[model samples]
Target: MFRDSLEAGARAVAAHFDHVLSDAADLPVLHAMRYATTGGKGLRGWLVLEGARLHDVAPERALWPACAIEAIHAYSLVHDDLPCMDDDDLRRGLPTVHRKWDEATAVLAGDALQALGFEMVADPRCHPDPLVRADLTLSLARAAGARGMVLGQALDMAAERADAPLDLQQITALQAGKTGALIAWSAEAGARLAHADLAPLTAYAERLGLAFQIADDILDVEGDAETVGKAVGKDAGRGKATFVSLLGLEGAKARATSLVTEACDALSPYGHRADALREAARFVISRRN
Candidate 1:
């Protein structure tokens, strides 16, 4: 139900952007942003709404900000799949933006989507509080910046060509910055938008993020492209540092279980405020795609 609600919200936002952005023929960039933002399974958006549910915030209000999170996620993937990055051709079973469109268009689309995410939160209809909107923008920016997701990406790439070697700690650190940062931001953004304190939620999201990454690493080793919707075994093939590569398959699975336990404990204070969160944590480790 939460995911369905978020999808409805995103459709509305996409329609809104399309209506406003259609006048510029020279700027196919805007259309690319709209297309990318509306795609995918909406895991990040669901996380935002789940966090907001903990605060008892209304779904309509949560939906718009959640849409913002989805936009940021979509933008990140577009850039991350470029030739300079992962060079991935497929994403969520569709050709990546760069492969479907031109490389320059893909780059511009990612840039525009980033701006659109912040703009959506700033819109008065989505958030009534200026301070809350500002906080969301700043928090999302930090999540996307060098200190967070980008730093993680840089670390991930550098580890591939590093002179020495990467231990489990280094691999985990990279995952924390890359995957964990955005997951943390999703929860933080939702909590702050609802005027709720995020101390416990932040802690829960941290563990949840780690668990999510561990599961991803495991899937890379065990999953096929039909199930994963992307290349598998490439991490090991390229000598890319990963939890599975360092910890072995069973060890990585064990670590994922431990993180899930830690995440569940962190949400104990919320009681039922975290029901959706708990479900999401379970889903994170168990999902095939």
Candidate 2:
């Protein structure tokens, strides 16, 4: 059921992208942006939708931030797969943006997607209240900017150049910013839209985000490139510190399980309404890609 919800949400967001991109003239960058945004689990966007549902927010309104988060996520992957970043050739079972096009196209596509993400929440379609739109825009900027995702990326690059690998605490902090920040924003977006309290979702997301990263680390150790839709074991190849490196496979898995439990528990206030989110937490650790 959760998988179904996730897929449906992904489709809805992709459709939104198609409609928005169609307004722009056809170009290589636009094509590259479409390519980059397509074919993924869409977990973050799904979280936004599900959280909005839980808050009684209308899908018409909820979709703005949902698609915004996905655009930002797509942009991150496009850049991450570039030669200067992960330097991968594949993503979601297709040639990565940089590999399919040129690196310059990839860079431009990424930049455009990032801008599009902000534009979604800032636009009047997102919410009628100017203050609400401003809040969403500000929070998105914080989540995607220097204080959040970018900070995590910088830390990651720094770790790569350092002699020693990151410790557990250090890695956890870095991921909280890099991966967790956007996730936090996605989960909390619904609450912001509804002007509801954010504590419950915030607690769920903190654990869920960390578990997601841990699962990714485990996947790198066990997954094949064909299934993962990207390079596998790159962290180990580069001697980078990961959950699997620091905690061992079994230990990392156990940690993920524990985090999922905590994340699910954080949803108790919502009763059965939160079941999908609980399942999402389980899916995080179980998914191979």
Candidate 2: residue pairs that collide: none
For model 1, residues 255-281, the per-residue Cα lDDT tens digits are 898888889888888887677677778
lDDT of each: 0.80, 0.93
User: What lDDT would candidate 1 get against the real structure?
Assistant: 0.80
Best by TM-score: 2
What is candidate 2's lDDT per residue for 1-289, written digit by digit as tens? 8788899999999998898778897899999988888899999999999999999999988899999999999999999888888888889989999889999999999999999999999989999999989999999999999899999999999999999999999999999999999999999999999998999999999999999999999999999989988889899999999999999999999999999999999999899999999999999999989
Q: How accurate is candidate 2 locally (lDDT)?
A: 0.93
Candidate 2: where is the Cα deviation over 4 Å?
none
